[model samples]
Target: MINTFTKPKRLYQEIGLRLYEELSDSRFSVGDRLPPERDIAERLGVSRAVVREALIMLELMGLVEVRKGSGIYLIKQPTDNSLNNELESTLDNDDVGPFEMMQARQLLESHVAEFAATQATKKDIIKMREALELEKQNIEVLDHNHDADKLFHLAIAEATQNSVLVDLVENLWERRESSPMWKQLHCHITDQTYRKKWLIDHEEILLAIQQKKPDAARMAMWRHLENVKDTLLILSEHKDPSFDGYLFSSNPVQI
Candidate 1:
């Protein structure tokens, strides 16, 4: 315990360790349903997104089960050995939170879209269209790497004629690709409706750039990212009253 903060654990890891420790109490046992996300969030002094990530980590560690319509249940009793093992394996996870990543992209990419509106050439427009066509072909597939989506965004960054911007955008995408937290959270989202909306968003963004509408391009890109973040957050909401939109009616964590 003396070295708990020695490695500087990430927020989700810290929260997850605390929750896992609580499972060791006599009041908790295998098969007991844990509290709702909102309740856990409030008590932990963190947002529901943070709580969701922590829960996902716990589920990945095999300590908890998240049933879609039912609340989270303890699937295994936590032991110090198991806790330290899982903690050692995942405590080094300093990757950006999915929502946090989206926020960064929204801020940076919206401005990039605006800049692209002024710098885009016929070649760039053609590249964007090709990416869109590929995206259109893959729209119905829910479990791919989203390569076309990446190409579309990278094409916009390239339109700026700045290698630094391209590197920055590419770096962000690569980070997202490598994030374990992102993968785990995405595994819980089953809805494909949002992908179609995103394709529509890409078309709107391309059109804005083609027309050289800087403001419209920025706004379209901004709105697209906001919708994406919202959809992912909504689709990943599993367990408790929140699973079906009854976010305010779930039970609090049992002490």
Candidate 2:
């Protein structure tokens, strides 16, 4: 007989599976509030970010409800009969890891910026300028969902005049939008302060591209993404001395 519950591939999925097994036992009951994210992280010897991702998987599976600024609540029991369907739902929507997505963007877009610095025409620069302006307005209005952010990124890719690069950037965004795991990660984050820092990073990227300095543009983009990854990982800090470090490298490149 084919086992309905397949093995987990990602770190978050593995954590989610562990939690699911715990929930299946008599330890937890319906409508009960689970332990705090910090406590869970300490107990599991994993980062709170990983625990958050696992909770998100449970949320997607309709097994728990994640109330912002409050706590996760058990919504439904994880019975074997329903486990197959719920597990499939969670797996389908969370096929990609959030860190992996950011790493890909860092690699691809940094090079795209390098190419943009060389290939960008006056018209391309104007388009990028417009996107940046729109992003500024969105930030000023305190808009949590910054649709213009993607526009700026796509503009950078488009400035490269490489159709394939534009398509790749767009595809990455599409994947992020469709990802339940990504959405879940953002749901817990209430701080809007990070947007301001990213805006400054955007300006640096634009300046380097406009100057036609490929090396500067590449480094600026690389640093901006490094900041982004760092900000996200701050939530995943593990105080446990024995806890293993992050799944991805903080600084993969030397320069």
Per-prediction TM-score:
0.87, 0.78
Put down candidate 1 lDDT per residue, 1-255, tens digits, no spaces.
234532525677778777866876545888998988887878998877677778888887888887887878998887667666666677776777777678789889999999999999999999999999888888755546599999999999999999999999999999999988789888887777678899999999999999999999999999898888778878887647654343222212211
lDDT of candidate model 1 versus the reference? 0.82
lDDT of each: 0.82, 0.79
TM value for model 2: 0.78
Worst 10 residues of 2 by lDDT: 235-244
| RMSD to truth, every model | 5.5, 4.4
| Angstrom error at residue 7, model 2 | 3.8
